[model samples]
Target: MGTLIFNLNMMKMMKYRLLFLYILGMTVAACNNDLPDELFVKRVVIAENGFQDLRLEYPEDGTVNTQITISISGTSVLSKDVEAQVKVCPDTLDDYNYERFVQDTMLYYTLLPEDCYTLENEGKVTIKKGDEYALLSVQFDLSRLDMFKDYVLPLEVSSVSDYEVGEPKYRKALFHLNILNNFSYVYTPSGAKVYNSGDNDDYTAWTTDLTLSTLNYNTCRMYAGGVYETDTDRDKYVIQVTVNSDSTLSYTAMTPEINLMAEGDASQNRISISESPDLLVQNKSVITTTLKMNYSYTYTSPEGYPYHRRFEGTFTNDRTVFRDKDGNIREEW
Candidate 1:
């Protein structure tokens, strides 16, 4: 009887010890789960400044090949090798889809086919061991896209092997591309001479300097005889120029009245300029235009003299080529 009791006691003690160990192990595991993960993306660095919107201006060199560099960094020096999958997918969000995504919390994005640009890397990126960051090279072809439309290229880190992805916004890099077709430019005018028919040779019609500042992507304000100066004494004239869909350049005078004199009686005598059919030209870099000017004047005299004069001539202007301080050509327009 003594041996049986001793054996039963030993078995019960052993079961209790095993149960205590199991509970302790579970508690330890739960405590460990509370700790944060150490591996994460530290920051994403872009090579160019103001790259968040990524507005690509039309290249003056006329080449479509342009590239931007991006780097992915980790919080600490990586101990083990890590791999990430990246893709350049089109932003398929239409007006309705975007609205729904904003309104509904459970919605996810669905990617559509990419039609506008070409990527050089086939959209794969990797970071090896001992490397703090990974570098990505992306080249965009602007010539393949329509200059008038808006496009987007979303560079996404789809998955990571050893480390957790960074912030939700940083995980996917969104590049909004807007192609600006503004053809406005500053030009030097030559071979421009004024012709007067109504005894008012004081009013010169030729433009020695001209500037076309863009009002929008397609239209511009063509100014002659100074920028933003509208006083009649300065002889300033403003015209509206537009770049049509067919790449043709056209212009119409915005201000029709050109006061010859501000204080004298000749102020009553003004030159009225009009261009018909919207002067069309093919080349933007250098252009020669012939416009007809009608000069109508009513002098404050005893005879009540009224004179109508017509002047016509050709004027040539060349776009001022932009250059860096080193004298290298930066742009044409």
Candidate 2:
């Protein structure tokens, strides 16, 4: 969205830079008036749209409200209101997918289902007199959507009451669903012991946090066995953990160099949530996740000595999400 026209004149001095910018602005103003007098025109456009990501906080009540704005482009403001017709355009989504991923079919976005969302404004927008844009409202039922699916709602300004329907490529857009990423970040790790099981020498507190990296959408990878991870052999101590739909945990060893296996009460390896009665009712609430696991791995040191270690503990991540006075959630935490 930002571009710098690196001209020698503009770079000469600060004063020259300001003057160059003024001249450029004047040039752009003159270009707008270059349209032939015989063929005057007004255009309705949605910025070049392949996929516009809209963030959703995973609202607790299952209901979500959002809006999109459409704008008109012209040299002069309209004296009267202008109406525009909008509709779901599947072909536009197709063009985007084909252009973006010709053969990588797996990454293409799926069309949002009808039951998941409701177009509250029906498909019409009226840009009022002296206004350049109008808003179209939408509501969504989060329970009906799959968190793993890449969903997009394709829309286009199909017709305008007076102005031209913009450029063919710029007229349409896709609203992509973007959900907050979960369960991957720094979490406090405690009650976990790290030591050379063979020598019984404790290496506890070698690392302070159970920092996790994304292994997949549903799983995270962390340093296992030797919690005191070094840059060179970090991959050798890698372990992946996944919280399943049934609240059970799944574990994996990324490399064979680390002898990975479960330990202690395997059945207790699960995710537990701390829920509040006033959850979404209070306009703001806290979310805390505690991951409990019992696992062990053996790492062979550079000197050909093997250090068998056990990682038995829980990692906790806690944060508060606040909602505003206008009922909008500020959930970036």
Candidate 3:
């Protein structure tokens, strides 16, 4: 009896294992069926008016013919009834005046209302479950500008199932162009200068150092780097000036010469002007001054380096002069 019972138990275990395998196989087949076959877009057709190639001219004043064709192929979805709807919404753009939030939505496409582009002639087509390929077509009208213009068009595709699929998506078609502009420039640029002296001789006679006042043109400021002074004493002052964009500048200076001799060492012939004179004459005296400047500018589009300009002017006032008290005039000054 024990041997018979053990054999019976072994047979029962084998039967149960076979039953589990059969059920598992059926489950897998069911899951596979639940997934839809893959659908593909094989070709896209763009109508003549659809895209404006600025490089290629269509009928500038009239219209042009345009169309789009799409091809598709896949295995799993062939057996199922598949229908698609094409929606083209020239994405709405915002042209606002608000400061904080400025949005640019360039929607430049013209399509029929109801916002749907149906494939003409062939509305619904059927494919066998094992079928490998299919095709879809979309058509539209495009208007041409009399002169020239810029525009953008967006195309979208999706499955039409009164039932929900996943989400809708689209691709963008870009177009750009330029028309005529009629505005005019009312103002023009001219050269202007600032100076301390009028003649070259006085320019050399004046002190080497010269201060530059803030310069302005049409409310714009200028910058500089190099030292600027009379050409005569160019070594004494190293003035660097850089003018800002859209501006021009000029400068001038005046300097005076001095006669001095050494008192202690007669042979030395110390010819120089006193650092600080006791008397500064207002009229009928000698005084010198110098001027220097730099310029910088820019353009609407990318341009080469700025145009650099340099100039000098010097002059002296014979009426107003500086002198020491002693009759011995200041020499080498």
Q: Highest TM-score: which candidate?
A: 2
**C-alpha displacement of 226 in model 1, angstroms?**
20
Indicate whether candidate 2 or candidate 3 has the larger TM-score. 2
Instruction: List runs of model 1 lying over 4 Å from the truth.
Output: 1-51, 60-74, 89-115, 180-333
**Model 2 per-residue lDDT at 38:** 33
Clash count, candidate 3: 72
Q: Give per-model TM-scores.
A: 0.38, 0.52, 0.25
For each predicted model, how many residue pairs clash, with residues at least 3 apart or on different chains? 0, 0, 72
lDDT of candidate 3 over 164-245, digit per residue (tens) = 2222222223222311111001111112232213332332222333333211111111121123333343432222222223
Clashing pairs in 1: none
Decreasing TM-score order of the candidates? 2, 1, 3
Candidate 2 residues lying further than 4 Å off, grouped into runs, are 1-40, 181-333
Q: For model 2, what is the error of residue 202's alpha carbon versus the real structure, in angstroms, after optimal superposition?
A: 14
- What digit string (tens of lDDT, one per residue) describes model 1 on residues 107-222? 53333236545555665556666675666655555545543234556666666775465554556555666444344444444433333344546445555455545445566564
Runs with alpha carbons beyond 4 Å of true place in candidate 3: 1-77, 92-147, 162-166, 170-333
Instruction: Evaluate all candidate structures by whole-model CA lDDT and list the values in order.
Output: 0.48, 0.74, 0.30
